[model samples]
Target: MPDDTVCDMWEVQRGFDELGRPLRDITFCVVDLETTGASVKAGDRITEIGAVKVRGGEVLAEFQTFVDPGTPVPPEITALTGITDRLLYGAPRIESALPTFLEFAHGTVLVAHNAPFDTGFLKHACADAGWAWPKFEVVDTAVLARRVLSRDEAPNCRLGTLARLFQTETTPNHRALEDARATVEVLHGLFSRIGGLGVQTLEELQAYSAKVTDAQRRKRGLADRLPDKPGVYLFRDDRDRVLYVGMSRNLRRRVRTYFTSSEKRSKMGQMVNLAHHVQGIECATDTEAAIRELRLIAEHAPRFNRRSRRQRRLHYVVLTQEPWPRLSIVRRLPRGEPGIGPFGRKELALAALEAIQETFPVRTCTDRFGRVPTRSRCLAADLGTCLAPCEGSVTPETYAALIRRVSEAMTVGAVDVVDALSRRMTIESDLERFEVAATHRDRLSAFSTAAMRSSRLTSIRTCPELIAARRCDDGRWQVHVIRYGRLAAAGVIPVDASAPAYVEALRALAESTDERDERTTVEESETLLRWLESPGVRLVDVVGAWACPVIVDPGGPLVELAG
Candidate 1:
């Protein structure tokens, strides 16, 4: 309040106002410290403190003091900071200096280049002096610079580099007051840079860099309007092109995560930079939201979504149309042929095929010699691994039965073949035929994985109306309504909600779902089963019979039928 004070150049206003206080109206204490060393844990001490209290881009007050560190300054520290021992001969100790600085910075956000370095020393000083440091909000200009400036503009977010880049009126000279003055200029530069990004509030400023802080923060306004409900969200570029598509149980919460530190994918950061807006489509249930997400991703083919961008080219293990129906991998299901899979990988399907061949004497020959052929048997027949229908060695009806068993192995579960392979592997390994044992082991693993995956898909596929419920943390049941393998609806019913009422509601929801016999994506089926199989989930109701021919064990292959 002194008339001769340098801060008299501008009027200082305190407290929030209508229309929310503009960033320019907010007060900030730009601070800097000259320390004897880089770390306080190593007994480093502040030799000098400097802070400039500013509002509306003009200085309101100034605070500066030299502190007697109670130890001689290191020669390197004096060289770096330009604060010699003589300079601090009559300085007040940190205990006294802190109170004066705190008074000047009262009711203001503290800012500094690399804030933690300065704030850490301040907090340590206060605690050492047996005083509680007031919980003042601190902002780091370095973090702001990283968000605002490109690496090309400033190679690093060093205070000196930023001061030079911004061409501040005062140059930092290793002196607290001068460096603080320079930081004040850098702070204003950052504020001006981020203002266009719509960071108008103190809270937004504090959270600016924590989220999509770069030019991507400009899209922060887009997420603000999203409804806080289950929905599909699309991140669109400047031309209104979708950059990414996603689904969330809570639209607002999920969309906001992209802009926050929780989003760690490197490509996501780049995606956000290209995104100019976020659009949300609210759904009646999480199940519907997820389905919508898949459809949107497929439609838009957004460059950012890694999965479900295209209709997957699924591989199926099918019986080769021959006298002896040998197992083979095919990209599409052959008409009128029973097969197992839409397996994601051909190699896996082949492994499943190999396992069936190893277990059953179903011929491995790629010939359609129905009943008999003039040609002789191949290597597989010579090894007795094939029934050799081509040579009239096995009847077509008998080979059909072997093919039927392989189909059963893929659809219901590979229990028989997997068990046989395990015994074979054990015997071979015990005899030290390690190579043969290893082949059996690999085939067993591949067959089990593919068969179980296909079985889960089939289980869901068979259900015309499926309702699964999982217990939420709050004792509510999160129910999913799945019709014809696609998620139709989802809802959370309170534990206290009457069971009759809940079932009736579910019935109504299920009836409203449009049923289609479309092939479900492997990912879609897997996601639903994962949630259903989670520890506390239960099958609440089934309009159509819901059954899995195999019991899924988290630790092993399909053990048995889920009776």
Candidate 2:
């Protein structure tokens, strides 16, 4: 095979083993191990283990025992397996049982309905006893069943049914011994159905499980598999190249969906064609999943995913970039030199001066040439809100002080910044910086803007912060924040950190902010608010928060729609 596109493991096997022609005579142990759950990594104790050996298609001997699970079995399991907490309360543990079973079945293949569940338990059991895990061949009876019967016709080819298929005459319950016997018979039936072709050795079968589309791969397993949960999954090629990286809320369901539903994912076609490899890392939380997926995508840049572009952006308040840095709004800070910059072109940078006109009724303006225009009580001035720079009610210096307050509200946050400002004003008055302190005194109203001056308002925080778009009941736009403030390690916060499911958070934030925007100090973003209240507004967690009505000279196109 060329180094081409890849198919899943089982798909790869069928490439050569059409119709599953066997390769050689093989000895197998029809085996069963009762464990706590699906994870072999988690210490799940097996209380019972059973094995029936067969060579040349004849019953050889049996190994069966109840090993104390080291922990009490829950009542539900006790009922299912009929292995009570008291039944094995004083029984010999696996350390004692394993040596005997290994010796009896040594050199033979291990077979089970779902081979991984049994083998994983056995491996863990062996490790707990401080023995090296001896690798061996395996045959999954479940896979064999799939090859022999149509699930729709047989509809119920369980171990018991498979025993009937072979006329092995065993109709056992959940006892490990009977199930093992049934599994052995199932394997025999499959072997006979294939014209008594020589079976692969135990080691070969286990290896083939990853590549073959035999009955074992298609049939449902006797053991319950892992649950569906949200997380990230990694798919690797035969050479261990990360073939694909994706995130999903339901981990098991999502992964299986790729294989089980041919229509849902055409990867099955690709998987079958190349018999590729895949494995997964499950994230504990959706946030973690999104973050991990994005990081992996960026790091490896898998062929299947579209790459994200790199751009320098700032969610900030901008004081004019020119002389004395006149105060105003900056919606989005642009890509520019990594410095206190007036980067990009200068026109868009100047448009922020229009904030004194378009947004706030606050009294402030610049001449058409974009300098502080002739003094007039800009609308804000007559309303007693602005210092009336035009009528000389407040001087250029005094007006600039107020602009700083607007900048803070637009940038850091309206409510939080206003609350801090109110406190700072009292402190400044006592210190006789009363004139200077009033810059922080303006009442929070309909709008404001932050000037991109210092890093003070945009410092990376200790915790993940949330910016939400929301719609008020009255159908107005609003934005809100739920900041857990500042985590220790500081760097450019990666945008891909959050998982896809987390996009739901915007609704919650919208509801929270809309309920309290009037009481809080931050001026909510109209765009965000409308987005929140819109029919399909979804909350998205990003590395940083941004407010609209941005005005910055990113050294790009003019009109200043962005910071």
Candidate 3:
């Protein structure tokens, strides 16, 4: 739990998350390099380095140096840069010059026109000198010009072209210092254009030069009020409808990305266009933020969110309560009934049901049976897949025993079903029926997944209430109160707070629950279980038994079910 490991499970937008700092507060090291050749891999090396550090349109410092390449300068390179072997007679080598440049630009954002060429050469120099390259935030002026200036404003992003367009006092002449000076002017000119589009921070400036649509960029003000903390955010339309919901460790940084090119999803772009405002809900911990996100998404069923919206479609495989028990696929399982799932897909539940039926001599037909059973039998009986209970071939007592086995396979353990399917797969494979073996493998996978999920969910659902705490990266304890697998309350224990008193207060503030049916969704229970079982988590207190049955394997050994 490193301090920087915030929201490890969530996907974060790539780039700097420093959106709070204004562009005027950022010191930029505008750098340019003259190289011996185009490709660094072709034994080319830096001939000269020129950089000007500026902040708020004020020049702070300038760095210029010539590096000896340890070889004769190419004739064409001399023609382009006007530097030759004679001019480099007393220059410092890269090993000496690289450290000085690095020290000069150590804490500033690196800016360059055609950044990759300049930064790539610097990185190569750092590597050759056995120095770890510092991770500097980079802004490319050429890239920004392409994003901000149209062809009518600037014919090309080349240094000479942009210099002429901006009427820069210093013009680029293929020399490092002069080109870098010219780029400073071009950079300022481009920043002014983006400033009108609401790009005010270094992070926003970098994102504005990306593939973000102009329409999306214009809505940057929507993220202005968000706090830089762990929380959930909601995007709302003009009619106050929630278009999307999400959570992040840094709310401001994450929400800001929605209007940037980093959010590449086309549906998100449409959602952003429709969005008129964004709302933030600050939380005490990342876990709390995640749970809040799930609850919000479930509550609103936001159009742009793809998950947790179709809980109604979740299916389960249950043993039907009837005169003659049979495995059935169901949308909802009765309370106190032994069932296998809350499978997200009906096809998956069906596959688990098929696997159970294949393993046991249970009735697959959907018809209800009475004491005086019908004489007619389904095709399964003819195919010898069923015991033909309708024909009175198997006694009621015997059928009940088989039903118990099926229930056990679904509820207590699935080793029997796994063993049966595995044996069949072996026989099918031995007979060279690879495709048939593959089908058996798939069914086994479905059954095992359902059984594992059911076991995990049942363990948490049966518990009355549990309080768990884990030490955070900052040495504070994150405490959560869970009631019947639902997150009831979450709070943090300060470094100086009393642990028992803090937890007791948190528990008192938790949501109260009655002894009713499991109220938490399967997804929420699974999420809580994962957090509870994660490393370094300690169970502070438990009101009831909170443990899952060991999953047994077919090879005569028991194994703990992985979270």
**Best prediction by lDDT:** 3
- Clash pairs for candidate 3: none
Candidate 3 segments whose C-alpha is farther than 4 A from its true place: 1-30, 34-47, 51-110, 116-137, 142-174, 178-205, 377-384, 514-519, 552-563
lDDT per residue (tens digit) for residues 243-304 in model 1: 99998866765676677666788999999888888899987555567767877877778888
lDDT of 2: 0.50
Q: Summarize candidate 3's per-residue lDDT along 94-170 as a digit string, tens digits.
A: 99999999999989999999999999999999998788999999999999899888899888889999999989999
Candidates ranked by lDDT, best first? 3, 1, 2
Tell me model 1's lDDT, rounded to 2 decimals: 0.75
Error of 2 at 317 (Å): 72
Better of 2 and 3 by TM-score: 3
lDDT winner, 1 or 3: 3
Tell me how candidate 3 scores on lDDT. 0.84
Rank order (by TM-score, best first): 3, 1, 2
Cα lDDT tens digits, model 2, 327-413, are 454544432212222223233334333333333334444433233445544555556544554454545566566656555444443
Backbone clash pairs in model 1 (N, Cα, C under 3 Å; residues 3+ apart or in different chains), count: 2
